[model samples]
Target chain A: MMVTGKKHEAAAAPSGAKLDLSHVSKVFRGGQGVHDISLSLEPEMIHGLIGANGSGKSTLLSLIAGQRFADSGLITYGGDHVNEHAAALSQICLVKTYERSWENYSLKEIFKFASIFYPHWDEQLASELMDKFQLKGSKNYQQLSRGGQSMTGIIKGLASRAPLTLLDEPVIGLDASMREIFYRTLLEDYSNNPRTFVVTTHLIEEAENLFERMVYIKRGRVAFQGPVEDFAANAVYASGPATVLEKLLGDVRVLHSERLGGKLLLALEDLSGPAERRMLQDQGVELSPVPLQKLFVYLTLRDAENSQGGGNR
Target chain B: MSYRSLMKFHLKDYRRGALILLSIFVCVDTALVLLMKFLPAWDMGTADNIFSINRNIMSIFMIISMIVTVAITFPLMSSFSVTRRNFYVSSLLALLAFCITAALAETAVYLIGRAVLPSIGLPVDVDRPILLSAYVFMLTLLDVSVATFLIGACYYRFKVITGTLLAIVYFGAVSLISQMFPSMEYMENFALFSSDPAMLEPGTTLLAWGIIALCAGAGWLIYRRTDIRM
Candidate 1:
């Protein structure tokens, strides 16, 4: 359903390393943090992670980055446990927003160091992209401004070309123009040498189009996940005769509903498609697709209402 | 990356602090030498030539040591807690600097001792290889060990601090409680050494190495358990 996706084509995953994050339950000593989450990530796609602060987004990234160890569950890269097996994690790269604090080296120096660790580092591409990002390679890390520092990290993440790339808000300080450039560069890079990318961001609406899949994390758990088309296809605008919309709610879960001067507007789950649309049309109903943001809000609120226990996060 | 390349990357980061430290050391050393020459000599009965290191000199060293420790650990006092990878990187740099400082301090003391000993009319043992080597080695070992323990204790207490009071209090309390108490001596009483001062004290050297290893291990363990971004 997206702009460029094939209609009759099989779902061919992007080519690069596959991530198997299975049964990942992490809890703080006093019984806090995320728990019992499980998901597998395939390559050649941009995965969006959406959540409010302290919702275990950063913790999940940290666990993947080798920054923090999980109390339980295993994160497998290329089918091997990353924490226990060194070989497994070599290809997966997680670049956190504050990762530079762990390193004091200059952008160029760190990149040089990373090249040896990440065998597939593309130096020429890094230099070219650095120019585009307007970063100073020779500058010391302490000297760069926040946005510039973020640019440095983004450059490293893109340049590494590691099989699995996790960017946790790498564009925090970027201007809108720079962010657009980043998205373009990301798309160009991915198109050329497709790798699995997981982008965690607050600016979901702007980048929703790029996400092959979106992981809307609510209260430290996967609230919803799957291909954008599949998830988007589930979105339905079931505006109809008030009685028909109300009665139609029995089998379909309506994510959102509104009464527009007695005419009803209801967003329902994706039931069996055309026949239901036809049935609704026959009953003087209306239907349409939901924007990514509306879907996020509706699903988030629904998940919150359902749980009543995710703690206000 | 290869180990040497990794080290170079970490070591290159000391550009700012090292330059700042080198300049401060140069200026302070110049000013101190001038001040010493400008002042009248303190009286030392029966030791006219000896440049006796007393309360003043010791206090200067104490201040300088604290300053160096503060400067060295500045980068670590952040929301980002150290990781095992970062621990190795920073420790390697710290170790190298510690060695270089020990060498310079020992050399300066030797020269000052040579000049001051003759002035005090004491027979200077310029060729006393055993004494010189033992004293140099002991002083170097003492400097590195003391510094390591000081940082370890400070890092353990607050993980990071800016106020001088916390650094001084934690460092003083830990060093005094651990070393001054007869039953709680550093390294020497861990049953890790059999050195007796009058009997060559060779086991003391072994104890020093053991203590260094223990501190390194402790540092790594602390880093492993701390929050990723504390």
Candidate 2:
């Protein structure tokens, strides 16, 4: 669904093999799970899955990758139901910090296993990425530092080149310089061979630019999923006299607000059209675009604030 | 393609362990046979065929090997995008191949011993045939390997406490059924080949095959429904 404000038009015909989830739910013990998550991903674009630590981003990715089975609903990829279809699963590659499977194996040994099993595995790409990442072939997987481990996971995801590649917290422990290298390499790889990628990460501002579409998950459901531009275009930061701002934002959705002296600063959702902006501008209010990261923070915190029965601090 | 890849991966993973175990077994067996021949003071009148010795050794090793391999391979199966069904089938296939190879290797070792021992004046009286004619021996190896796989799957699908408790209850029920049916002589007779290599009765062979099928089927069900913990 479009964020509370903007009305999205019918999307273009799906470009390629789409990843589709319909009413999927997977509940773990203690009631932690994704609930009724229905999303369709068009092929050959990067989508960012942004959520808080317990917001089910990781769980949703796992279900999509077929690493975990859904309790109810259907997950399909490229026209095949992934849960029971081995061929369909083979088309998707999930790169996670798998602490168990390859812990005893050396980096070279893991590469061998990856190349053997992944149909689209690119040995040359893997070797090149390994060199770039400076990962030693002889080091045991479990022996690597956290960043070193993340580098190995990144190489696997990029080199697999499956139709749908998922990287959950791919850059968990990388330094700033290394993260830059990852982004550059990721972009280069995507350009060289386009595919669908769903990356779940906490470094939103750093990686937001790379995402063509953004999916905001809150409390196990999709709060928003649309083009990144759509998300950013929907939120506006407005500041003006407190009384004027209150009257101007009368019925408009105020996601976040701050009282600075007598002037009030507000983050409003779905205030994109020229008519609303012009009307607010005429009322002597200053407006600027809210960054995707700030909008995410505002939306998530607003929900939490409402649930807890507290006004925005 | 996925099945073949999984089998190759399993073989690679198990290569080191299998080699070490086989090497140790062969070395110990060969050393003992040589000691018996060269040092008469150490030699006993008792006959020792490599196959007979390994029949017991391999059964224990195979069970351990199967359990460890299944535990290690289960997670890798998901990482490599191999389906749970394929993982179960491919692992079972790998174990079957491993058992067949071990069976053949034991037979060859026995044949070699038959030739080499006499030349060294330490002939062994192998009462049982070296290969499939030792039907109960081969069946025991296969049964334990598959049963151990089921145990590993159980531990994987359910964590330790629940898995262990369930296994105890299930085995207890099986024992109760076996006790209730005194005519199920195969349960007791299957291990009798250690003393004598009497041919397994056709009915007993059928029952043995059925039990193998049941264990393998149960293992598959557990694996098929298991969710990979990321």
For every candidate structure, what is the RMSD over all alpha carbons to the true structure, in angstroms? 8.0, 7.1
Task: In angstroms, give how far residue A284 of model 1 lies from its true place.
Answer: 1.5
**Candidate topping TM-score:** 2
lDDT of 1 by residue, A1-313 (tens): 1222331121133246667777787777556567777988877778888876666888887676555678778787776666524444556677777653435557776666565555456677678878988787788767777777778778778776766788889889899999999998889887866778999987778888889887767777887788877666768777767877777655437778788777888877565477877888898887788877787677667666666664432
After superposition, candidate 1 runs with Cα above 4 Å error: A1-15, A29-32, A84-88, A100-118, A138-146, A241-243, A246-252, A273-276, A304-313, B41-101, B104-203, B224-227
lDDT value, candidate 1, whole model: 0.59
User: Stretches of candidate 2 above 4 Å error?
Assistant: A1-15, A240-265, A270-285, A303-313, B26-57, B108-127, B132-134, B169-192, B199-203
Clashing pairs in 1: B48-B120, B49-B116, B49-B119, B49-B120
Assess the local accuracy of residue A11 in candidate 1 as a C-alpha lDDT between 0 and 100: 17
- For candidate 2, what is the TM-score? 0.84
lDDT of each: 0.59, 0.76
